[model samples]
Target chain A: MEYFFELLLSGLTRGSIYALIALGYTMVYGIIQLINFAHGEVYMIGAFTALIVASILTMLGWNEIAILFIASVVAVVYSMAYGYTLEKVAYKPLRHAPRLSALISAIGMSLFLQNYVLLAQTSDFMPFPSLIPDLEILEPIAHLITTPEIAIILTTAIVMVLLTFMIKFTRVGKAMRATSQDREMAMLVGVDVNRVISITFIVGSATAALGGVLIASHVGQINFYIGFIAGIKAFVAAVLGGIGSMPGAVLGSLVLGCAEAFFTGFVSSDYEDVFAFIILVVILIFRPAGILGRSDISKV
Target chain B: MLELKNIKTFYGNIQALKDVSIEISEGEIITLIGANGAGKSTTLMSICGIVPPRSGEILFMGKPIQDMAPNNIVSLGICQVPEGRRIFPFLTVAENLDMGAFLRKDKDEIKRDIEYIYELFPILAERRNQAGGTLSGGEQQMLAISRALMAKPRLLLMDEPSLGLAPLIVKQIFEIIKKINTENKTTIFLVEQNANMALKVAHRGYVMETGRVSMSDTAANLLANDEVRKAYLGI
Candidate 1:
């Protein structure tokens, strides 16, 4: 029973991180219908940005709280810039091209960013200092919960709430929804479709940056290759919930996270990834449209 | 008022509009009618800058607007209800309407326009919260027109507004189009395959054949012509 409770708690914490990253994937896909293959690298760039910012802040004698906030902001800004540049350089030219070509371009971008980072930074995993204090809560429940876990859950929830509000209430959000639903129609109505697309990338990249910072703070280290597996997991989560659905991404992440945690705790950690991939395949075969995706009838 | 002088449009190498010429005077409803590939939609699209003419000129209100972007064309008060009633399927009816006024900043006026549009298409008001994708064909057509009207365009371009509706629903749509033109005095450039319905509403009309203007005359004259009646109206 105790093991079960501990696994559940850990799963929820990890689920929160996956949810944060999955939001980026879902959002970019929502607006532009591009999978944004470079999103995972944006995640990696965020962590590196945080590392640099934290090191600089610490050298300047800043406190832990100050460093964490500043590092988060720096990561978000850097990742947003990277995402914007990626869209302008890679995705924009292929706007009217075949979907297969864009898919290949995205894969190429993923490889390019990973290799670029590998050359710039060390290929090996490096330690990232713990930015948040790890609080051992739930002593009565055998310390089933911790402050970092609470923080992760709270931060992810807060961001989700804010994002929902933005999408529902703001003008820009409406523009995004319009562009996503019908690009040519949106342009006819005077919504700058290109601007909305860029904003989508920026928002997705910024959220991904936050996820990177939070995960680094939680896990304590990262490598240039860290984004690949995590990116695949989040992509699965996005697909599970519905690629263009915000709430779906969060829901999918939670399910994947809990499943993986239970599998690792009871069955074996070695088979953790296999479980996720199997779930994805099964879901694809059974419910290809996803839990939240709308079924589109082919127009004759 | 709008004028297209020897305008040519192509879909890659295949010319869709070959030296097509027409004029629309202010507050008049002018229509282009023909068969499926008669280049009717191409003429409207070119005016809205979705498909710019390869050669020749389009003058809107006496200013050349041949190279403007689609959004810029809308901002200059030339708006289009594209073919297929291309409503944003995922958006709520109200949100879809709001998108029509995306370039405008007048909040009070926008609200007034929304209310007016609802009154014009009361079914749309009832379904304001519904996703656009779920609307019936007639309702979607209504929303497309209402969305275009939200722009308060000086010139309204409608492409195949009656393409896929029941005959009764088609009558209702044409009635509304007539009301919009007479009441609002907005210039209308309509592209349609329904020749009979179009000629009934248009002050002047053109018959397009194989990417060229086969005939241009008063709507009454075109309706009475033997060639137009046989080839287009199936009379």
Candidate 2:
């Protein structure tokens, strides 16, 4: 029973991180109907940004908590810039082109950003300092969960609550809902569709950056290739819940995370990824539209 | 209120409107009647700056607006109720009305306009919280028109409001269109396949064939013209 609780806690931490990354995937897909394959590259860039900022702050003898917050803020700003430019250069011109063309451009972009980072920084793994402070109060259950894991779960919950509030009550959120359903009509009603698209990219990139920074601190090292694997996993989560549904993405991530954690703890760790894919395939065969995804009911 | 001089619009290399000259005075209800693929919607879209004319001038209230963005055109008090009554399906009826007033700044005025809309279409008020997709076709049409009215436009452009509705519903909508024009004195640019219903309300009309305006006259004269009656009115 103790072992079971430990595995569940770890799975929750992992699920939270996946939720952060999966949101970007789901939102971009929701608004533009593009998979945004370079999303992983954005996460990689965020991690790299945080590392560089933290190193500078540490050299300046800043407090550890201060370094964490400042580094995260800088990383978010940089990732937003990258996301904005990525949409303009890679996707904007192809807005009217075939979906395949935009998709290919995304692939090319993912490769380009990876290589750019590889050349600028080394391809070798870099050690990352733990940014989340150890909470003395939770020391009673220290065996079951770590401070970094607690930090991740708490942060994800806050982010989700804020995101849900924004989507449900804000004016921009209303425009986003309208634009997603019928873009031309949105234009007719005076929505600046291009601006909405930019905002979506910015918001999505911010969440991915938060995920990147948090995971780097938890894992103790990053080679950036981590983004590709983590990104693929999150994409799987988004698909599991329903590609375009926000709540679906988080639910899917939690389920996937728990499934992997249990399989690794009880069975062999080597088959963790294999087991995840098998679950996805089995679920898809039965529910192609995903757990919460409404099958397309396009009206003529 | 608006003028299109020698306007030529193209979708890629294929022309949709060619040399489409038109003049609309303030407070007049003008309509363009044509068959499918005859460039009627394209003309409205071009005027609204969704598709800007390639090489010509579109002057709204004597200001050159040929190169403005869609939102900018909308800010100039030109709002469109596009073809198919393309309401956002996921949005509730009330939210759809709010979206129509997206560019407006006056909160009090917006609220008042919404109330007016509710009064104008009591059925829409009843379905205010319902998702637009769940509404029947006639109900959606009412919501679409009300959504446009929320913008408080001096000129309203309606595309095929009568396209797919029962005759009784169509009559109700046409009556509302007439009421809107007279009550607000808004200049209207109506595009429709239902020529008979349109001409009865329009002060003047243009007949578009292929991509050109083949004829232009008073609405009553066009209704009586043998050529228009046979080809369009089915008289």
Candidate 3:
């Protein structure tokens, strides 16, 4: 029972990070039908920015909580700029081109960003600063959970709730939904599709930055190549949840996280990555549209 | 009022509209009747700035608007009810209506306009919360027109609103169109394949063949012309 609880706690923590990253993939796909392959690099950039900010703030004699707050804010802002620029420079011009061409452009962008970061920052992994204070108030359950794990879960929950409300109740959200349903029709109805697409990238990239900060603090490490593997896993999660469905992305992330945790806990840890892909293949074979995805029927 | 002077549009290498000149006066129902591939729909698309005329000018209220974007054209009070009633399938009827008034900031007026749309199409009011895709074909067409009307457009472009509908439903839709024109005093440009029904309701008629306006006359004159009677009226 104790082992099961430990696995569950760890699974939820990891799943929160995956869920945040997967949302960027899902939303960009929803509006433009493009799988933003470079999103993981945005996450990596977030972590590096946070790390640099923390190191500078610490040297300047800021307190721990203040450093965490300031570092996260700066990282998130920088990631937002990166995301907006990525879309405008890399994706926007190719929008009217063939789907295959756009896809190739995205992969090229992913490679370019990864190499750019490698050249700018060190190729070696750097230690992430642990700024979250250890709480002694949960001593009884501390064996199963940590303070950082609690923080990650709480932040994910709050962000998810806020995102749901915004997508459901706001005007821009309605425009997004409309555009996703039918782009040409949405335009005829007075929607500025370019603005909507840009906003989607901004929001998605900001959330990815948050995920990057949380995961870096939790794992106590950062590297340029980390985004590649993490991004592939989050892509699997998005595919598992129904690529364009927001709630489906979160649910898929949780399922993927829990499956990975249990596999590592009970089965051979050596083949953990293999297990995630195997699950994706099996689920796709059974339901090609994904768990929560509605099958699109083109009208004549 | 709107005017298209010597407008030409193409689909890649093939021309869809060639030297198409048209003029519409305010508070009049102008109908363009033609067979399939006669450039009737292309005329509407050019006016709405979806496909800019390769040459000539499109003047809405005497100002050239050939370079404006589609969304900007809507804000200028020209709205289109596109063919096949392209309502957002997943959105509820009420939500779809709300999207129609997307560019408006007058909150109270938007609310009142919505109420007016409901009164015009009571079936839409009853199915307000239902998903748009689940509605019947006739109902979807009604929602499409109502959605466009929600924009409070001075000029409404309708593309075959009566297509694929029953005779009774077509009559009902035509009655609603006439009511909207007479009551709201809106200028209308209608494209239709059903010549008999279209001519009965229009103040003036233009007969398009291939990619140009082959004939233009008052509705009564076109209804009496020998060629029109034989070719369109099945006399």
lDDT of 3 by residue, B91-127 (tens): 8999999999989899999999999999888999999
Chain A TM-scores, candidates in order? 0.96, 0.98, 0.98
What TM-score, over all chains together, does every model reach?
A: 0.97, 0.98, 0.98
For model 2, how does the per-residue alpha-carbon lDDT over B33-128 read when each residue is reduced to its tens digit? 999999999999998888889988999999999898898899999999998888888889999999999999999999999999988889988999
lDDT of 1: 0.89
Interface RMSD of each: 1.4, 0.9, 1.0
**Displacement of the residue A254 alpha carbon in candidate 1, Å:** 0.8
Deviation of model 1 at B23, angstroms: 1.5
Ranking by lDDT: 3, 2, 1
Model 2 bad stretches (over 4 Å): none
Ranked by DockQ, the better of candidates 1 and 2 is 2
Q: Which docking band does candidate 2 fall into?
A: high
RMSD (Cα, Å) of model 1: 1.7
lDDT (tens digit, per residue) of candidate 3 on A6-41: 999899888889999999999999999999999999
Of the true interface contacts, the fraction found in model 1 is 0.85
